[model samples]
Target: MSALTGAAAVAGCGGDDAGGTSSNSPGATSGGAERDCSLKHPVCTAVTSDCVAVHDNQGATTLGLRMAQLTITKPDVLASGYVAGLVTQGLTMNLPQCNLNGTGTFSWLLEFDTTTGKLRTGGAMPTVDPREGYCFANMTAGEFEIAPTEIDAPLTDGAWSGEAETLNVPIFLETSPEPIILPLHQVRLTDAKVSADNNCIGRYNVEGLEWDNACLPGQDGDPPAFINGGKLAAFITLEEVDRVIVDAVKQSLCVVLSGDIVKYGTGADTNTCKRDENDQIVLKGDWCSATNSPATDDCADAYALGGEYAASAVKINGLCPQ
Candidate 1:
């Protein structure tokens, strides 16, 4: 087993891998660079292989959320019109409509209900590997040790809802280095659906993103299936969110709709900030760092975060490494 590790910051994700599959094929995808280091996904197919193995009959099937599709619903809050103006509108009103996907390699683990059951999901990150932390090819099931995340929502035939008090994710915003510990005080995974065969869990779709062709080399012509789709939400601290937006906290806005909040009380809460024409308490300075932790400890609180994901399952089996 390895020590607990976390991936920091999310940028252009990866390159060097253990299996050596994700890099360049040297055929044609490498159009510009000598080896195109783009995120190439594995070919999608309903693998009937039973990967749901409990560590010594421990009553849990471990899984790694190899690919994660994250979303930030409203990035255009600054340009929103009568979308229930955040300034003068009521307290609880629809902010706006826009979806911005969060990029980065997502390394997550889970203990499913049954190897092939439906909607059985609950787990955490690998005890050690943090995406860029291990070569995907060199990973083993043993390496996918469980972390200290707890969620108790069972499989249901109704609306999706599950809760985790505090979930810390190690995101490899950048692959070469370590991971960033993105803290979620209150976390929720909604509308989560598990496939019939359980080997796969998604039907994730994002137009030009992880679509049909993105599922990689097909398996006996299984006619691209987009099954990875779900909503995962949490209240993220500004420090964690800053890592994704590259520390753009000062320019960040938490529209309260009705001028209720005297101060942001969130974001980069600093004394140096002041108000402009609008009563928005404007702050300054980079409150976060991809390579470092938050500037202030008090900033570890949270802001409502909405994330939509289409994740696929990968076994925890550790294999070859370079």
Candidate 2:
């Protein structure tokens, strides 16, 4: 988010007998108003010149939070496939408002070649490994708005409630049990709050979230079985978040996720994934057994789901350090 100064109120002046004119020009006032609008105002165009900047800041922050949650609750997937080499390119964001009842949306096409650099594989489950691939998300039509009732005034000083439509993104998993297109949908982030200043959001909190990946059929046409629903809470100072974004632009972004993640629903079966006393993820199940088998392999069944598998901890190319 960028800081914008509000337009200075111009007093309308009455012409004098000598036909004196106001010092402020109409064009100048209009331009200034346009500049001050954006998120600075309660409403503005979704697509603006600073759209990329805003998205890079806010979007990346959102993604980082998501990654942090994934690392804490799904370390198996984060370690083996969703590594740090991934980056999103060609992004376009359209935020219609910076307050409640306003739309916050964006869409982007991905370029994995730049991020992965090369294909690589080797992990507990050799079936799926980190590899180069592509992904795209078109969430421009989704609704994003603030909750007026939750706002503590001074507008930019206190916690603010916000909500965004569920995200549906398509990803190409090149090295899974079989290369396939996985459409992750029904991904909702709820009870979100942002602590902010006039310039940016210093920290954010998400109370509940859910993402389902049952779009594709399983082996032999079985029902797709990856479902993740949980709650995530984390903190990242805006300054630190900005640095990460800068590094990411240079293709050097390394994110170390350290946070609290709670899993629920069908995914909480064994409850073996948990955080250590130091807040690092700790994996506890056998990772080598086949799914639903009587075998004692801890993570095998979990790992098979790729992005859906939960883990206690994850370190990705030094990005997500233990």
Candidate 3:
């Protein structure tokens, strides 16, 4: 197994110029772009094998990573006539709404679970049961919802441009009287994380300007990342939430960190073995790459899940499932 390594950053959240670009912006989503890469959308079917696993030989450990793009809707926060009157008679109390059309990718691993077929993230943990990470059961099991974590992909090509606007009346415009409008320029992921069987992740970028609300600094704002291809739209729906749970509970693919599962395990520890009844086999010698010491780290703590998988492994079949 080769040691995992890479450089990733979430471009600082600064002024428009300082902030890094997002996926699905104008001129970002072009033909043949990695961001737009995906399999054709099949008809909406019941919980089945929407997942396709590409296998590879490794040591005793079997790691699998699945990627999927999904559509999600954001619940809109509408202020009634009363709230609108407080701001300005005719103006509406507007807030950002998730743009379901935006496409994003989610990823998960497959390992063993004592109760179900496997154990994943996003479940009650021994220490914190209700709090968990992304997990998936067998191929048919749905994905589980864990706290949302940010995937850092550098701002290369295939990026999207967007903005978020909000109304701030920090002080009643005693003199100016007009509620100051705060506009936050931003970039969003065009693809949303739809399900566990279809979680997606990677160096995401975009090609089209999903132009949303345009504003002049204050008063109200554009639909930020939640718009065309932003945050809220990036959430997993209840339909396949359990799959996420299953995937989260499963182990991440070794190929995600070593180009091949065999190398991943060998690099980590040639003697490591996969224990069927015990979940310790895969994560037994888990260590912190930054610290280089065995520590109790969760799947999210692994370097591969942190966008280091690109160099460590070859992206095949849109994901790597060992």
Candidate 4:
């Protein structure tokens, strides 16, 4: 799998600038003439043309990274939510292919005893591809509780509980030219409470989450990354495990001295996560580019077009079983 490789500073949060003359800015002057390069520009044939490729690629990479992290770090949480309805009848989870060559197919035949909240594999568990870095084999046996009868508990209405142990899981991030791979060592999740309402939409929220040695790159030397606070929300269905929709917002501080990356703050500045009315994650932003020409310099209005220019970059909707 292609992972983002570079310093975090250069791979800053994705966003569009209001107005700038930087060549990297989408709406910069093409020539000496003032030209309106916004989507409404009469001369500009396509306003979103520049934003399409980068936007879509970034969105896909982000979604894939999030899904892979969730899957690798906490399979029990997923099993409980995706297969909650089949507790008594039993089910085999056929994971969809996540790679380009259609090879990361995984299967788990699980039988759940709803009466005792015990879960066990019915047959030999399929070996997860090591290249994918998801430790599925460690989830062979576990216990789960769907619709726990606890009162005054958050997500009590449709909550699932489970636990697992993960070692050296890899998480990917997008940089300017390449992807960066970070190794999370000795990670463990216990008392994981996942919400199964609306088909496991609340599976992103976890309880008792801990990790060690997240080796992030730095100038002086590699430093351990820290998470001050964050919220990750996802919507997933059992039929499609590969195309999980996710919205993640994190508040953290890191010293990246290698590249020119954006520093994320703690408030709305970190609200890069966006979702639609249906609670499905959506890429929201405009890609406005302007010519240097004086006639088309007013590309500021391009931001107001108000539509997802990176719709083609989304893959979660079509992540059906293959």
Model 2 stretches astray by more than 4 angstroms: 1-75, 79-83, 87-166, 170-182, 197-322
lDDT digits (tens) for residues 231-264 of candidate 4: 2221221112112111121211110110111331
- Expressed as tens digits, the lDDT of each residue in 1-322 for candidate 1 is 0000111111122223322333332111545343321233222112332211112222235434433433334322211332112111111101010011122233454444443433223233322322222223221122122234445655444234577766655443322233334455556677765454443346422232322233221221122113235776655444333333212122222322112223533324421223457743343222322223333543422345565544544444442232
Residues forming the 10-long window of minimal summed lDDT in candidate 2: 87-96
Worst lDDT run of 10 residues, candidate 3, spans 305-314
Candidate 4: which stretches are off by over 4 Å?
Answer: 1-113, 119-156, 160-187, 190-322
Best by lDDT: 1
Better of 1 and 4 by lDDT: 1
Local accuracy of candidate 3 as per-residue lDDT tens digits, 56-144: 21221222332221112211111212111122211110110111121111222222222232212111111111012223211211121
Provide the overall lDDT of each model, using Cα atoms, as 2-decimal numbers.
Answer: 0.34, 0.20, 0.21, 0.19
TM-score, per-candidate, Cα-based: 0.43, 0.21, 0.18, 0.19
Worst 10 residues of 1 by lDDT: 91-100
Backbone clash total, candidate 4? 29
The whole-model C-alpha lDDT of candidate 2 against the native structure comes to 0.20
Q: Tell me the lDDT of candidate 3.
A: 0.21
**Clash totals for all candidate models:** 28, 14, 81, 29
- Best model number under TM-score: 1
